[model samples]
Target: MSDFATNARLATAALRDLFDPTPLQRNDHLSAQYDAEIWLKREDLAPVRSYKIRGAVNAMRKVRATNPAQQVFVCASAGNHAQGVAYACRHFGVQGTIFMPVTTPQQKIEKTRVFGGDSVDIVLTGDYFDQTLAAAQNFCTDQNAHFLSPFDDPDVIEGQASVAVEMLEQLGRAPDLVVLPVGGGGLASGVTAYMRAESPKTQFRFVEPVGGASLTAALAHDGPTTISRVNSFVDGAAVARLGVCTYDFLKWVDPAHVLLAPEDRICVTMLEMLNVEGIVLEPAGALSVDVLPELSDQIRGKAVVCVTSGGNFDFERLPEVKERAQRYSGLKKYFILRMPQRPGALREFLMMLGPDDDIARFEYLKKSARNFGSVLIGIETKSADNFRQLFDNMGKAGFSFRDITADEALAEFLV
Candidate 1:
């Protein structure tokens, strides 16, 4: 075996002491939908509810083995990585100091604390993740402690390869295609490297959030480069830049195989999995599955595996998710209407709505002229064609309106 295969196998064996291998189950729903043998590697079911635990455990274990006196570890994360490090620290009986952004959710903070118990300290410092990460690194250097990078380190990448080890072992044979979600590139690079060594014939596809496609940017630029802006809605996979170490491993990937998933469209997939398959996936976790439709022709009659990265979803965000899903599917719309300042005008508009059409929001913005007023309206209907019919009816009735559903700035401000 090559050095990478040996190390990856050893890492996988060590992970057995932490938690059982995550399930690799054939998904009937997806299989039928795409006419392919579809399987899901449920990394979401890991002890930390993510594959992050594998990297954390392996990295910490190797560090301790090399230097027995290194007892302190530090890391910065706002979600899964924080919990993974905390759990690993508790398991090894070592002290850990975790730094998180002040804007992190309370639920994540509490979960990290619970996992570490008395073995870790949580520090809420910066408003942004970059600020928190900088503070943590400075602290680690000042105290002469080891800093665990979320995905940039070699040990962490090798540890993450454990996922591919378990995947092949569970499936018993090489899958035709493996679809992976890419963020900082830890999981993708690790799995791709290991698979390339073990099953050279296997093909790979990578998915990234459209607004935070760092891997795509790296491949285009021939190196890791920072993106100016990132949409954090898919918080798990929304990285501004690909890590130098990870990019090196993934630099040879084909640009065509890297799929970009729109943030709103991912919400539609999340809702579908939750409602149909009884699977709860966070936005980032749904990335691989979200692009499956686009690959329908390519994936037909083949065996495919999608890595469901994590299920650390907060139910409080359900409403926002539903709204985005509806908007993306064209079942919901928002518009500003010019309403005549006359008696019974409201009733006239209300009568124009079809049976399936429901008013989700209505507000009179201003009565600027003596004969007309501005009104904001949000409508939800059963189909996109309903909006077309409604608009046609309104136009015939002398109603003028501007659709703001696709206008990000206007929708953010008014809706």
Candidate 2:
């Protein structure tokens, strides 16, 4: 076996001391939908509810072994990595400090605190992650503490490879394909590297959030590079830049194998899993599953595995998730309706509504013309077809309406 494959097995053995291997369960819903055998590597079931704990724990163990006196660990993160590090610090009885952006949600901060307890200290720093990272590094330098990188370090990468080792052992044989979600590329790089050496025939397809396609960017530039803007909705995988160590391992990946998943569309997958399978997945965790429909043809009659990388979803975002799902599925819409200045005009418009349609928002947007006033209307219905029927009826009634659901400027200000 290759050195990476050997080391990965050793890492997996070491992880058995920390936590049992995460489940590799076949998903009937996905299997039936894709007309193939679909298995999920449930990293979400880990103690910290993420695969990150593996890397964090493994890195800490290796560092403590080599350095002997390096008892302090530090990291900067706003999500899973922070929780992973905190959980490790407590488990190892080591002193650890974590820096987080001030804008991080209260729920995340609370979870980190609960996991670390007295073993770790939480530092609320800059508004942006870059500033927080700089602060953490500077503190590490002054305190002579070991900085546990979220993805860029070699030990962390090796630790992540344990996921692949466990997968091979659990599945018995290599699957035809594995779908991995990418952030800074730690997990994807680690899994791919080990699989390439140990299971040469296992094909891989990578998924990244559309707003933060760092892996694709790195492949394009042949190195790690920062993006101008990144939408942080997929907080777990929305990385602005790929990691240097990770990108070096992944630079050879075919750009065509990388798929960009739209941020809003992920909401539909999250809801589907939650409602249909009684499984709750954070946006980033659902990435691999979200791309199933896109890869349905490629995976048909084959065996596939999807790594669900995290489940640290905050229930507070449920309403927003449902809203995005509704919007993406075309079940809700916003539009402007021009109403005549007559008194009964509103009543006449109400009568044209479809049975399944409900008015979610209605406001008079006065137009400059004295003869007519514009009304901003938001509608929620059972099906997209309901909107078509409502539009047809309005057209026949001589009422002019414009769909502003997709108008960025209008929807932002009004919807």
Candidate 3:
């Protein structure tokens, strides 16, 4: 075996002291849908509810092994990475300081504290993640502590490779393809490295959120570059830039093999997994499964593995998830209706609706005209075709309306 592969196996063996390997289960639901042998490496079921713990544990363990007296470790994260680091700190009986943005949800903060127990300290600082990261790094330097990069460090990457090692051992053979969700590229790079050395013929497909496609950008630019904007809906994987260490390992990946999952479309996948498979996946965790339909043709009759990266979804976002899923599936829409400012105008508009159409939101907004007023309306229907009939009927009745569901500015402002 190659040195990297050997080290990955060693990491995997040592990880038994922390937690057992996560499940690699055959998913009949996805397998039947794509006519392939679909297996899910259930990292979501990990104690920390993510594959992040693998990297954190590996990094911390190796650091302690090399410097037995080193007891301080620090990291900055508001999500799974923070929890992972906290869990490792408690397990190894080391002191850890984790920094998170001030805006981070209370649920995440509490979870980190619960995992770390007496072994870690939680610092809430800065309004944004970048600011929080700077604070954490500065503190790390001041304390002479080991700073764990969530995905960029060599030890972290080696620790992540344990996922691939366990996969090979669990499946007893290499699969035809492995679909990985990419954030900072730590898991993808580590898995690819070990898989390439062990299962030389296996192929890979990388999935990134459309709004934060740093890996695709890095491939195009020939190096890591920060993206201009990132949509934070898929917070777990919404990374603005690929890590330099991770990008180096993933540089050989073809740009064509990387797939982008739209943020709204990912909502549909999350709902499907929850409703159909009784699996609750966060937006980032659903990335691998979200791209299955796109690869249906290529994966047919082949064995494929998808890494469902995390399940740290807050139940409070369920309503928003359903709304986005409905929008993406065309079962819901928001529009600005130019209603005549007269008696029984709403009744006339309601009369045009089909039996399956239901009004979800209705608010009258006074626009620049006195004769007519604008109504911000949200409609949900059983079928997308219901909206088509409703629109046609409204047009025939001389009622004019503008669909604002896709109008970013207007939707953000009024809807």
Candidate 3 lDDT over 1-415, as tens digits, reads: 9999999999999889988999999999999999999999999999989999999999999899999999999999989999999999999999999999999999999999999999999999999899999999999889999999999998899998999999999999989999999999999999999999999999999999999999999999999999999999999999999999999999999999999999999999999999999987889999999999999999999999999999999999999999999999999999988998778977999999888998999988876667799888999999998998999999998888999999889888887
**Candidate 1: residue 76 lDDT (0-100):** 97
Instruction: Give lDDT tens digits, candidate 1, residues 133-233.
Output: 99999999899999998899888999999989988998999999999999999999899999999999999999999999999999999999899999999
- lDDT (CA) per prediction: 0.95, 0.93, 0.94
Clashing pairs counted in every model:
0, 0, 0
Worst 10 residues of 3 by lDDT: 363-372
| Candidates, ranked, lDDT | 1, 3, 2
Superposed by TM-score, candidate 2 places the C-alpha of residue 232 at a distance from the truth, in angstroms, of: 0.8
TM-score of model 1 relative to the true fold?
Answer: 0.99
For 155-181, candidate 2 gives per-residue lDDT tens digits of 888899988998998999999999999
lDDT of 1 at 116: 99
Candidate 2 Cα errors over 4 Å, as ranges: 367-369
Best by TM-score: 1
